[model samples]
Target: MSCLPVCTQRMKELAKERELEHGKRIEWNDWVADNLVVQFEKLVFPRRSQLPRASAVPHWEYSCQRLNHAFVRDEYSQLTLIPSVRENELVLQFHDFETMGQKSDGEIIFLDDITQAQALPSQDSVLHLLPAADEPQSAGYFCRFAIRDRSNANAACITPLNSGLLSRQDRWKRPRYAPSKPIVIDLSPRDLGLAEGFSQAEFDIIAGLGFDSEQDMSWRTRYPTATIYDESPPSVLSHMRRGKLLPPQDVKAGVPKVLIFSETGPLVIGGGEDPYFDLPLLNIINELNASEDDFDFLVSIQPAGILHPQCLPSFAKAVLELLKKRNSVHVFSVRLPDHGISNSQTYIVLLASPICSDVPWPATHLDTKSIEEQICHLKSKNPRADDTHPTAGKHVFLNPAGQVNVYNHGTGQLPDATDRPYFKTVDFESNIILPTLYSDHGWLHPTRHDILTVRECARIQGFPDDYIFYGADKALRSQIIASFPPPIARGIAEAIRKIIKEHTAPGLDASTFAALNLGGRPQKRTRVD
Candidate 1:
């Protein structure tokens, strides 16, 4: 018998005391020596020696409460049979035994057909009876085991344990953390260019957008039916196949019920920004309409990218081409300057003008006034269309030298190098200047120089204050926001909801669908005045 350190110390102490009392130390066979050993063993291994109670840990009911809604399963709780120590009992050890058998002449004798039979209650086996933490002491103190005949499990002598049950009222106790309410966006619709009616009161007014991640993981869980279609690191097909995020379906099943694209059809399907007008996705939609069952779904796209400024009108044309009901296709985007026209037009003027001249550009056949005057008129017509200012914080810089330094307001332009709080984004070779969100910096706060923080970018995109983004870096979070602005998405969704409701209802005229002004492609705007 090996003694613990404390036990060894006490044994030596006892020997020394006995030597003082007697001529020599006490013998091992002596009654006093045996009593000391037993006392030491008791001290080494002490137990609370109390009856098991439900309060030891939260009962199985509490474990169930830890589960998400409709996520309750057996993994929450477990149970296992741990054999207690018994004296001189014959325990047969079978390492490779799986069949039901009995011992006979140093060999195993199988009863009945043993080919399909299996051994139950293996040493490592655990039964998940309830979703609760395992308590070894509870089994030791409260459970009682009875031997049952292997041949007849139905006639087993085991008795039920009734102590685990709690009162009926206790079963409905609240969980440690309550579930949050779903976000609801109520929208008030109006004519085009008039969305600003609610801008002051309803829509969040913030500057800049960011995109760091492709998929918003929260959206997958929050809105399971909403599927994001993008071509990137994780292909749309691969993303849809990931379990729980999308419904299990074959590739031939065609498009999902609700597909959301952060960018327009051309950007996603391929092709660069020079001529940002294409219809690969729209063509697919047109083909899908050939069969009634093929495209019975709603497709929403937000084409607010600088490259595809005309995405709304382009998508509108596609919807117009649809032979079937065009109301199912919707485009949700902010009105911005068309880069194809805006950037090229500005670049042309910059090249034509004399660098030393006070005037910007010469007048053309289109306008009677100078090119600068024409530009000013266009700017006044589209007041909020200037995309050049990196930050929303605007300033008028006046220099006595009058050195002409023009910035492309159509594309994002950084402040001068000498300016305080200045930051320069990495350049892209494909384009002379970076597009709306591709640039490195944004003006989010009224007075800040560094790139927009993730929180500020989220605020600009109309994400709720409480909404949390899942990502490792600011780049990933920025990407997600730039691609999908919740405010714009909500507007489109609201429009779709109304269109769907009206489309399905009886006595609704086909002409009314066109009158909604939410569907169909749009043409270039004529001068209002």
Candidate 2:
């Protein structure tokens, strides 16, 4: 076992940390050659084939540390490039060095032809290396080499090809085609060498991988596909959605809205005023740490078809000032397109908080009615698609008045008075509050509960105890707190800050920064003639 002469002290330390089997050491080039042999065989033969004899490819032990030091110390000029090697158009790079199990980077160099070497047959030939766990060292080496006499090439300068500099005819087919969508491969937990009952979340963390810049881009472009060990196709789709590689189809942007809390009731500002009537909400912007210049995005909270030219300028100015002062704020408008909900009134005074769900009900307040019986009763009454669903009535409470639960309606939009309220238990274990049903219209806890108190809703939304939601009625206060949860707001603000920092980072080109803002795609406009 010959070890390369460089970084001797560090190599010894690494060997101690990552104990080598039997203290066996192998040179970097030998590892590369072994991998190339395995990959080349895979291309020529079927998977699960018996191991073939190693190829006669010449594996020269080159020191990556020495080469990098040569470049750093300006000794590259002393080495001469032979014309024959240049004619062959071979590539040589200091692939990397490893001591024990740790890897250290080496220099990259391009090579061409050399004398007394077997010229590769016209470059369409292939080598496909997939690293195996058994021989960890013989993995990730992606270059093909030609065998030559040791005396023919200089010992001081070794040439290895960069992984991707293939001949025009030698490119791998289907690198892009295969990964167009995520792939699902079935494997049992036992097959993956896992104990019984390994949870899905644990599996995901174990399967996740990180790659370097070059390799990362390569995999992203060539293999955008995700491999799911589970057999379920929906699971694969769900994973991809989480990765943001697949945009969610049902992501409706929340409308810009403003609610003013008062002792009388919660009022939707701007009944007689201009569309930007809630511009006064900008006062809250002073609480943020950022200056006015930091704000770059805006949402207009206008009621439909109610533009006020006279108030427009002032509203715009207020918004600009708010942007300069706050980290992030979103505006939701009262008018929603295709929402089927009414927006006729500019201001709303909710009489009291509606008890849309059973979340606030104590065990003593819950009815003795079995959840199954309630679901069956609800299904019998309202057979409409908007009424019953597979999971809707299960584990969910129903109003004896046959109200529609928000989950059952499935509209991703605000509800109106016509909709009756149905209640469901919050997934308290997961910290997720189910959407509020139209409880103001007589939705009740099985025990006939009323809407949650202003403080209760605030707590569920992750608001601190001190934060208050004061308004006209319990219903109105609940609406204000429920519409915008504190946790959701915090997540959005953090994401915005990160994006802003990336955009404002020094040395980022305009096109790249713009691409980041637009999500790395050319922005297209809807043509309206």
lDDT values of the candidates?
0.27, 0.26
Predictions: Cα RMSD each: 33.6, 31.2
Worst 10 residues of 2 by lDDT: 349-358
What's the lDDT for residue 304 in model 1? 21
TM-score of each: 0.29, 0.21
Tens-digit lDDT string for candidate 1 (246-316):
42222122111232223321133223333556544454444333322322233333322322323334544
Best candidate according to lDDT = 1
True-structure Cα RMSD, model 2: 31.2
Question: On a 0 to 1 TM-score scale, where does candidate 2 land against the true structure?
Answer: 0.21
Off by over 4 Å in 1: 1-218, 221-258, 264-280, 290-299, 302-317, 324-333, 336-438, 444-449, 503-529
The backbone clash count of each candidate, in order, is 18, 33
